[model samples]
Target: MKTLKLILIFCLLFLFTLSFAQTKGSFKVIVHKSNSNSSLNKVEISKLFLKKTTRWKGSKQKVEPVDLVDTSPVRENFSTEIHNKKVGAIKAYWQKLIFSGRRVPPPEKKTDIDVLKYVHENTGAIGYVSNSANLKNYDVKILKVE
Candidate 1:
């Protein structure tokens, strides 16, 4: 009976760990605190980042989407999860848009700090970072993706 109890405890712990484990390719979208967007799902984020939508529905503030460098893992994950496309594919899409004179891609920042700074300074700016980022000291708002 003791052995069975131990085994059951181990199983419960394993399941709990698995449940709380960070999701694969997980990312967080952040915006300036002034933006007042509490949450945005994948479609709204994709549209904003892709420049398909220009303004925040809340305050009608123009949306200024920012991007991390293409080489960052967060950027890659964000490209995959939010855009449902690889980084190269997103690049190609941007290229087509640029050539068609339809839209310009968001400015790419070199690091998470830089992206955060840009978002912090610009009321309309929105950007993404890794799930592990420590945003405790930052004045940015993280928008939930459901």
Candidate 2:
């Protein structure tokens, strides 16, 4: 009986560890070098993602934000934790905006390296990528979400 109990406990602990492990990849929010210093609240960041706001009023430059591919863990995290919406809900919201011709989705990159490169090169760009990826060479700034 004692041996059986020990095995059960081990199984439960293993399952718990797997469930709470840091996601396979890291994620981070990056901004263009020009806007590196600009402080943005969660609302402003969400507005940008939803395409509700397009231009940076202060710089008079167009904003270019990128999103992770649909259903990706990073994307899911950003949508739910940062944008405060579920995946399906955010998708529906974007569809409506696209249909109205009010906004277009941001460019999607295959990997964090690509996102880092794109944001670093574009003056008005912003993107998210895994946190594990090294960002030493990029000129972009990483933003902290509240």
Candidate 3:
């Protein structure tokens, strides 16, 4: 009985550790290389993505936030970690906005490379991609999330 209990405890601890690691998904926020801001806190980032904030601070340039497809795992993690909401909830929020004609969600790209391309080409664009994406060749700036 003692040995069995010890094994059970070890298994539970392993499972807990695994879940915690999985919850901390990896991704990076990026913007056009010319964007002046170097970093932004989560709240600021969230506002930009949600369309609550329309322009970059201290600049007349309009902010063009982009999103990954609803089905992308990077989008799933970004929705949870940055927006503190699930992807489905985000979709619903955008749907209501579109129905009311208040706003539209950021354009969704199908892949990280596509997002990189968009951000690189648009001076006011901001986007996120999986951490594993090859950004070496892209002329984009990785924003530090505070």
Candidate 4:
């Protein structure tokens, strides 16, 4: 009985640690160096991801948005923290929007590097990635959330 109790406690501790890591993982909203704005609030960033704010108006051009894969943990955290909704809900919103031909979702990449590359190469693009990603060599800049 004692061994069984100890095993149960260990399992619970493991689960708790996983949940803590999920909640603690850091994220960063990023844009190319050419973007004039250095930071944006959650609401504005949320709008961009939701297709409510489709373009970043430049002196003579528009910028697009890039996104991480739907299943990524970092994406999930971003959706929860910035969009105030779960990933599933966001996906549903996009589905409805697409069905109605009212909107199109941003381009999605499978890895943080892909997202950074997209934002780096496109002057008008913005994206997000894990905070610990190797961004030193890229022309990407982090956008502070106000």
Candidate 5:
């Protein structure tokens, strides 16, 4: 019985570790270099992505949030970390709004390059990309998330 208990505990620990690893994602929030705000809290970032805040403070530029394709791991991590929800839940939120003609979800890019390109070109755009994405050639800066 003691041996069986130990085996069960070991399996539980392994499952816990695996689950934790899956929830953590490597990503960085980025914006056009011209944006004055250097950092934002998670709530502020969430508001921007959710369209609750449509305009940049002290500016007339509209906030354009971009997302990675639904299947992308970066997108999954982003939804989990920033919105505290799964990607499907976020999609559902957008779907309800769209059904009512209220709003639409942010545009989704297929890859990190596309996202970087979009955010670099749009002054008010905000996006997240994989931590491995090279931003050196892009006219964008990473926004420190607090």
Candidate 6:
């Protein structure tokens, strides 16, 4: 009986550890060095993500926003935490915009490393990644969400 109880305890502990491991951390929106000091509010950031605003003010260069697709956990977190919308709702919103020919979805990268590299090189780019990512070599600044 004691041996059986010990095995049961081990199984429960293993399940608990697995559950904890599944939880992920939040990511922060960041901008390329050229857009670091833009003073963008949450509304503006939302607009950029929604493709409502396209151009940078000082220059004619178009501002590019990058995002992960519907399946990404980071995308899900950003939709829920930052945008206050479910993933499905966000997809519908983008679908409407695309159907109207007003905007196209931002280019997507498969990983945070790809996002970091793309944003770092592009002057008018913005993207998000896990806050714990190593960003020392990149000249990017995290945007403060209002």
TM-score of each candidate? Answer: 0.81, 0.78, 0.84, 0.80, 0.83, 0.75
Clashing pairs in 1: none
- The Cα local distance difference test for each model comes to 0.88, 0.79, 0.92, 0.86, 0.93, 0.80
Q: Candidate 2 overall Cα lDDT vs. reference?
A: 0.79
Q: What are the per-residue Cα lDDT tens digits for candidate 5 across 48-89?
A: 999999999877689999999999988988988999999999
The residue pairs in collision within model 5 are none
- Per-residue lDDT tens digits for candidate 3, residues 1-146, read 99999999999999999977775456899998889999999999999999999989988689999999999888999988899999999999999999999999999999999999999889999999988788887789899999
Cα lDDT of model 2 by residue, 1-146, tens digit: 99999999999999888866666544778888678345677888888777678877588677888887776778877787678898789888878878998876787777788888888998888788876778888998887765
Off by over 4 Å in 2: 1-26, 36-38
Tell me how far the alpha carbon of residue 139 in candidate 5 is from the true structure, in angstroms, after superposition: 0.7
Model 6, clash count?
0
The stretch of ten residues in a row with the least summed lDDT in candidate 4 is 54-63
Least accurate 10 contiguous residues by lDDT in model 3 = 18-27
RMSD of candidate 5 to true structure, Å: 4.9
Q: lDDT-based ranking, best first?
A: 5, 3, 1, 4, 6, 2
Please write out the lDDT profile of model 6 over residues 1-146, one tens digit for every residue: 99999999999999998866544747778888777355667777877777778887677577888987667788888778767898899789878878998877888787788888888999888888876677779978887777
Deviating ranges (above 4 Å) for candidate 6: 1-23, 36-38, 57-60
The stretch of ten residues in a row with the least summed lDDT in candidate 1 is 18-27
TM-score of 3: 0.84
- Candidate 6 collision pairs: none
